[model samples]
Target: AQSVAQPEDQVNVAEGNPLTVKCTYSVSGNPYLFWYVQYPNRGLQFLLKYITGDNLVKGSYGFEAEFNKSQTSFHLKKPSALVSDSALYFCAVRDFWSGGYNKLIFGAGTRLAVHP
Candidate 1:
């Protein structure tokens, strides 16, 4: 079964500093991983993805991730951290089931707290 893991339950960073939300995945065949951010009482917002093409994939809000096949890791990174960036982060992998039904297998969720 395909699965994702967020090693850290929470990450604390100071505002204006770089932040990283780590994610790792285990899957059969090709790997499709994604990063999303959720604010309080808000839906998950798409951040970046590593479907193919490049090892380093860029996405919204100055965020990016590097796909490392050797390590089986896809860690979300931002050069700078902001108070507004404090939220719940999730890493998901696409899962394919019988009958062509596909779904997302998400991690437990990592809470990012940026302090001023």
Candidate 2:
């Protein structure tokens, strides 16, 4: 089984300051990690993914995440945050050995609050 943990229930950051949201995972074998964001009353939208490649991966909206295999962590970072960046963020893990079916297990989620 694969699972993700976002220890923080919420992250508070001031506008124009850099922000980071932490995520960790546990799974057997290689893990496919993903990040998604959700706005008010809107469905979750894909933000970034770590399938294979460089340890550092960049995604939409000036967000980036570093994959640490040893730590089993993929923490989301933004150079500078905006008030509009306030949203719900989720970390998900996918296990390929799950009987050939695509199953994504999501974290409890971390709410980002960007105060102006």
Candidate 3:
């Protein structure tokens, strides 16, 4: 089964500092990986995705992620953090056999606390 795990329940970072929210996954064959952010009571905002190609992929709000095939991990990263960036993050994965619905299997979610 394809699955994702976010080891951290929360990450604390001061505004303007680099930040990272770790994520790892398990899947058979190739998997489609994604990162999403959500503010309280709001739907998830797409951050980035790793289909194939470059190991490092950049996305909205200056966010980026590196896909490590060897480790089966896709960790979100940013050069600098913002207080407004504080929110809930989730890592997701979907396998080809799961159909083309983009029906993702997500992690428990990580809270990013960015202090100004």
Error of 2 at 45 (Å): 0.3
Q: What is the lDDT for 23 in model 3?
A: 99
Give per-residue CA lDDT, model 2, range 1-116, as digits (tens). 56899999999999999999999999988888999999999999999999899989999999999999999999999999999999999999887677866588899999999999
Q: Residue 2 of candidate 3: its Cα lDDT?
A: 69
Mind giving the per-residue lDDT tens digits that candidate 1 earns over 1-116? 67899999999999999998999999988887899899999999999888889899999989999999999999999999999999999999888552344478999999999999
Please give the range of 10 consecutive residues that has the lowest summed lDDT in model 1.
Answer: 94-103
lDDT of candidate 1 at residue 13, scale 0 to 100? 98
lDDT, candidate 3, equals 0.94
- Using lDDT as the measure, name the better of candidate 1 and candidate 2: 2
Residue 52, model 2: lDDT of: 92
| lDDT of the candidates, in the order given | 0.91, 0.94, 0.94
Clashing pairs in 1: none
Better of 2 and 3 by TM-score: 3
Tens digits of per-residue lDDT, candidate 3, 1-116, equal 66799999999999999999999999988879999999999999999999999999999999999999999999999999999999999999986577778878899999999999
Which residue runs does candidate 3 get wrong by more than 4 Å?
Answer: none
Off by over 4 Å in 2: none
Model 2 lowest lDDT segment of ten:
94-103
* lDDT accuracy of residue 25 in candidate 1: 92
